[model samples]
Target: MKILGIDPGLRVTGFGVIEKQGARLAYIASGTIRTPDGDLPQRLKSILSGVGEVIGTYRPDCAAIEKVFVNVNPQSTLLLGQARGAAICGLVQADLAVAEYTALQVKKAVVGHGKAHKQQVQDMVQRLLSLSGLPGTDAADALGVAICHAHSGDALKALQAFAPALGGKGLRMRGGRLVG
Candidate 1:
């Protein structure tokens, strides 16, 4: 399965593609989309188009994106949320299933801790993907999101396989968690 991971920002959005072959993950591509220093509408449009181009190029099976984190400033948080919404719009337009992960969840999945710093995440991403050099901070976070999805996908498959044995308890998983 090929997965596209996105980290959305008004000025710059990061994207990474990874393929899951059985139990192993291989990196395909990683890059950043830089928006012009202009008005907010143009910036939002850039994000939407940039994300759409990525999906068209990679043709990933699914996409995972970082959820917006609340900032101290309400306006900042709202702007971040808009950026995320634009990214998600691109994914949904491509008819792809989208998974949202919080920063804490992504950090824990990649670095084994929610409080890991940016350098740690970049190092871990390099190690996991066997990259020669460290990816940029935003790109590393994007790749980390993909890696997180890969791990969660495996667990979800396992759960689905065993769900039947749970006596048809009406259990189901949505957004990587089990529900009944």
Candidate 2:
């Protein structure tokens, strides 16, 4: 499966594309979209168009994006959310299923720890995708988000394979847990 990941920011949005074949992942592309200093709406338009162009170029089967975390400054958090929303709009417009991952979840999936620093994540992402060099911090985080989705996608498929049996038992998975 081909996957595209996005790390949305008002100033700089990062994007990465990878192809997953069973247990292996191969890097396809990674880069950042820098918006000029200007009005908020224009910045968001840049993000939306930038993301759409990436999607068109990569044509990923699915996409994953980093979720916006609440920042110390409420305004900053709100702006980040807007950027994320623009990315999502692009993905959905292309009829892609978008999975969202938190920074902690992405770090744990890529680096095996939630507290890993940026360099650690870049190192792990390089190792995982067997890249020749380290990706930029924003691009690395976007790749991490894609990696997380790849891992979780396997688990979700496994669960789906057993859905029929679980349904017979009047049980289901709710939010990653079994419920009866």
The lDDT of model 2 is 0.91
18-83: candidate 1 lDDT, tens digit per residue: 999998899999999898998899999999999999988999999999999989999989998999
> Taking the tens digit of each residue's C-alpha lDDT, what string does model 2 give over 59-153?
99999999899889999999999999999999999999998889999999999999999999999999999999989999998898989999988
Kindly report which residue stretches of model 1 are placed more than 4 angstroms away from their true locations once superposed. Answer: 169-171
Model 2 earns a TM-score of 0.92
| Top-scoring candidate (lDDT) | 1
Which pairs of residues have clashing backbones in candidate 1?
Answer: none
TM-score of each: 0.95, 0.92
CA deviation > 4 Å runs, candidate 2: 162-180
Among these predicted structures, which one has the highest TM-score? Answer: 1
lDDT of 1 at 134: 97
Candidate 1 overall lDDT versus native: 0.92
